[model samples]
Target: MSDDPTGPPVSERTALRADCASCFGLCCVALTLTASADFAINKDAGTPCPNLAEDFRCGIHTRLRREGFSGCTVYDCFGAGQKVSQETYAGQDWRTSPDIARQMFRVFPVMRQLHELLWYLTEALTLPAAVSLHAELRASLDATERLTRLPAEDLAELDVSEHRDRVAALLLRAGELERAGVARRGKRSRRGADLIGARLTGADLRGAELRGAYLIAADLRGADLRRAELIGADFRDADLSDADLTGALFLTQAQLNAAKGNAATKLPDSLTRPSHWSADRLPTA
Candidate 1:
């Protein structure tokens, strides 16, 4: 259990993280893959990737990046895959029961979206500054959890975007309140900015609103990004070497995987350092 009064127990957060062993490789088959810098081949939704084994494990799990499927490495189902495969379908494999394949695939994305919201809501409850909204956040978390356990048919038909909008509003308010204490006048509100490849090395972006910002390939080495709102911020190829991201809002493991960071990149307690990063390597002059 968390010692902090405002924080949730560790189990609550762990329940929302992906457990691939309990999943049926839903992401390997159900989602579409476009041939880009991320994926090696173009695959339509519902078609199994050639690398998916009968046991639902990736054939090239260790060599995904080398095999040109780097995008697969960054995609997280947020525990939705296992929930759908194990609980929703009662541990049924799509290979054995092909009849449910289409519906199961349809429901996976919706459940993923819900789980993502649960992730953010869970984090929001941990923020001391968002204490006033904690009651509402808990309610939202409970309601969203109930939705995740709905029948497969109902899940496939769920209007997750509308629910997301409502949740987003509450999260927005929580972020504002949390940032208000640490954010300087000019550091707040960079929500959805086009900062792709911009030079921001050693920058002080504390408590900045960086939601949905195109920070692809941005130079963010040694930046002070503590308490910044990083939801949906593109970190693809962005250099986060030595960047302090402790307490950064809504920063996911997937985003860290997409970015270029070394061992010196400080992360939030909820997230881990991506294994692909160099071990304690320093930035070049």
Candidate 2:
């Protein structure tokens, strides 16, 4: 077993992860998709993807990428889809009533943001360096959890960004405390840095502050990213064939799913190797 102290109890953690079987395909209908490397067709907000089946399952789920719906595979709603479909709406679906559907769609995104914050706050609470902030983190997590249970109308009208901004500030302080020892060595902060397509193969990035870095298409093969603050980092198409990310902070499954990796890439115990990642191209670690 791993020694990473950066996750909630198994049940709570499972709730934070997506449960598509309990969802009503909210992501397919509530969000928009544009034609690009990620998607093969254009879809408007509130419009359901043509691939969504009558029972709220994807028609090409097992072959989304092969069918030009690669974007679908990377999206994670942090369990908001099921929360909206089952808890908030009490199992009501859009297909039966246009009004309920509209409200559900509007509330889906709001719930997603709240859930994302909960995920981060929960992780922060688990960090030993952030022990001083545990009380506040717990409070924030509770408040965010309550928001997720609000009625559909209230959720639709919620100013989720405001809450997100507040949580982001708290998370920043916690991250700073966790990375303080490394920061003393003059390691530069790379928050929101635009390093798109930059070559960083075999780089040592331990304890680096790379929050929100645009590492899209960056060559990061064999890089060391342990304890790196990677919240909001864009890793689209970045290579991670043999990268060690055992302790990467605030790294989400969606981010990993969007990037390229192989069997040799070491990941935190909290995260799983993405199914799309190359399983046989490299030897296992």
Candidate 3:
């Protein structure tokens, strides 16, 4: 983490960590679910998940995956749940005041999006190669943070796309500078490439730029992705069981959560191993 007083932009250590204790099961109530393989049953929006407890805990928390609530395991509000419950709603849960339920559900997602931007902005500021753009990044971060604290009505009407576009442009420049600073020139850039299920085991991809690549279910076991620019790569179901991603750039927890990985997968320091990856499913030494 960058040791920034406002907290590391992307590290969900405390500020952005999911403080479930302070939340009122917003994820369960606000998010609609379909009876896909990931979920056991279809659920409507604004209705609480059947497994939710009165105290806002998942009744089947320990057995969520086996119990057909696998989708819940990968969801991360990035502390937006707690922020809405504690900060925005001021400790008033939707259950106690049913009238505010609709507004609270609407505000939760907006806060989550704003928090996602904060993560990206924070990461950009830490890149030394992007120093020239630091002033603008900081300003954007400050402005974005201010927006997260707005009233629910204003948040609902927020132009998130505009803010996202602004942040994305700044990040693109930052990525370019970082890539240029690297000693190895002419690195591979498979940006927006469709490499679905391609057998790329043990491929040498150091300093690769794979921004927005479609890598779904690709067999990338033991591939080296150190310092790779994965800005918007689709890693869902990607076989990264033994991949080296220690210095991978622009990778987020939400992205990792969606992907398939095991214990041997080397990840960035700021992120943690997903709970869904069991020891039996990991790559053998």
Q: Judged by lDDT, which candidate is best?
A: 1
Worst 10 residues of 3 by lDDT: 1-10
Q: Clash pairs of candidate 3?
A: none
Model 3 C-alpha lDDT per residue in residues 1-285, reported as the tens digit of each score:
243433334333457768788999999999889998679999888899999999999999999888987778877888889989999989999999999999999899889988877777778777777787877787888888899899888987777998899888898888878777666656867989999998888887777788899998888888888878888898877888888998788888877877878888999987888877644545533
Best-first order by TM-score: 1, 2, 3
Model 2, span 1-285: residue lDDT tens: 122334442127678889999999999999999999899999999999999999999999999999898889899998888989889998888998777888889999999998888888878877888877777777788888989988888999999878888999999999988887554354799999999998888888888999999999998888889888999999999998899998789999999999999988999888999998998656323
- Candidate 2 deviant stretches above 4 angstroms: 1-11, 183-186, 281-285
Local distance difference test, candidate 2: 0.87
Count of backbone collisions in candidate 2: 0
lDDT for position 181 in model 3: 61
Model 3: how far is 5 from its true place, Å?
Answer: 14
The TM-score between candidate 3 and the true structure equals 0.90
What's the residue-level lDDT of 81 in candidate 1? Answer: 91
Off by over 4 Å in 1: 1-11, 183-185
Compute the lDDT of residue 25 as modeled in candidate 3. Answer: 98
TM-score of each: 0.96, 0.93, 0.90
Cα misplacement distance, residue 149 of candidate 1 (Å)? 1.1
